[model samples]
Target: MSQTTARSAPSKSDIAVVPPRRPSPWRDRLSRLDVKASPYLYIAPFFLVFGVVGLFPLLYTGYVSLFDWELGDDNPVFIGFDNYVELFGDDQFYKTLTNTVSIFLLSSGPQIVIAVLLAALLNARLRMPTAWRVGVLLPYAASLVAIGIIFANLFGPNYGLVNSVFELLGLDRVDWQANRFASHIAIAIMVNWRWTGYNALIILAAMKAIPREIYEAAWVDGASPMRRFFSITLPLLRPTLIFVVVTSTIGGLQIFTEPKLFDAMPGSNNGGSTNQFQTVTLYMYQTAFEGQHFGYASATAWVLFLVILVIASLNFLLTRRLVR
Candidate 1:
């Protein structure tokens, strides 16, 4: 019996027949948690930063808008909607709104048209293409304040380059800041100059992403360049066009430095002699800094934000319709 037990128990194969050890519960739980929560842990930083910096300040700004707060005043009077009511009643606000909309339309409309054309031109196979693209983006990279200063000199009534050119051609020198309309034109010119190339570059990137087979198919069908652009390129590029339009609208509505500097000459207080070029943003700045009405300025900012939101929503809806 002892010999039989030794033969059954002492064999290495018999010893190796023990069941495989089970994994520890703690290690299994840790592995499961790592698999489930690793993604969330990676993305948590974005939410935390946005909550702290973006959402909190936006909520605070909204709360601050419903008050009678001055820059130097110690007490902020709780005046619900009074600032908004006063804003509505103020002629300056209406004027600023009109100018903002006008400039946005004027600049964005032509910018879209010109940008589409330039983008088409750039989409063609060309030598030194990257250099050309960089050249186009130069103005956008330049400082807005510097652009404003340069344009101010260019649009000067006397001894300005624009006036000099007009005189050389025996044409009348335009009084660029004499009225609201002319000031709007000047601001539009500056905006268009600065943004057109940037928009064109964006559209060009979109155009390049389109499959070459579509263009080749159109070409085989004897489609002209313009026909291909209208039927194929524009349709495919609709989403990019909408993006450019919305961004342009936002920038144009918030135009400040160009108009402000243009009107910074003698006898031009709140953006030109007639306040024609004063955008809502410019007005907000003047209200906060010059008029010392901080609450009113905040209200103006909120109104401007709403205007941008509405316009952007409309653009998005239009884009959806076009896409369909």
Candidate 2:
């Protein structure tokens, strides 16, 4: 038997077709504008602040370096490169440069070594690790002026704790303030003491960020702690080491306060009895304020800035090569 199936009639709503709504030009334009302009608006404040405080001062210093400007001088004479020329010829400038480099060398190498060692120690399992890490940073948080004073007294030639220890060991007391190299050593000690812990914390953070799986595999392969550190950890820490080294170079070269305050001799502002430990910054301060050679001091500052740039670049290159 054949059966016929009846179909139901279609409703008006089912036959009707609805077209897509047209895009709003203003809304589309506003969205596109927001996408394009949002990033710049967010970042504008930083550039504005930097232009006012950082870039303007840097450019102004460079401009002032080309003049024969002095402190309290209303009408400054425009002399092109005269200050730089004079700076190159100045014996005192060369001496200060030497002292700056010397102190930097004394401090930077040992500081990095100690910082790495401390980081390694701190990365190990220990009781109250947070307390230990915070304790290490105390010296960095302390006042620089106080650290300088305490170190100065400790390094004093006579009646200082360091000298007393030397005498106890049957060695003659070395005059840290009067002697140039000794004074550099003393300043370096202070720099290392203050900054090593801070650097160690930075390095420890880097260490903590390294993947644990790699270390676990190395352990399964019978690698010792020292082996794992040298092979896995040190290689992974390259970027952090580069940052630490570059910053240390900059800070070491610009050292002023420690040497300035470490000089315990009465009425001596020249870094020592004969300007023995005077760094570039100390000399620049003396030239600008005491001798009223603002132009010359600006020239000195520019030169030091260039030197720091070059050295920091070299450090980055060298570290990149050595780490690999």
lDDT top scorer: 2
Candidate 2: TM-score? 0.91
TM-score of each: 0.87, 0.91
* Pairs clashing within candidate 1: none
lDDT string, candidate 2, 1-324, tens digits: 111211254445433422246446797898899999999999999999999999998999999999899999999999999999998999888999999999998999899888989999999999999999999999999999999899999999888999999999999999998888888999999999999999999999999999999999999999999899889988899999999999999999999889889987643458987889989999999889888989989999999999999999999999888876
C-alpha positional error of residue 312 in candidate 2 after TM-score superposition, expressed in Å: 0.4
Regions more than 4 Å wrong, model 1: 1-37, 266-269, 322-324
| Candidate 1 lDDT, 1-324, residue by residue in tens | 646766766776544554367456798899899999998999999988998998887777677789888988898999999999999899999998999899888888898899989988888888999999998899999998889889988988877899999999999988887866777888899989999999999999999999999999999999999888889998899888888878877777788877887885643348776787888998999888888888899899999999999998887788667754
Cα RMSD (Å) per model?
Answer: 4.7, 6.3
- Worst 10-residue lDDT window, candidate 2: 1-10
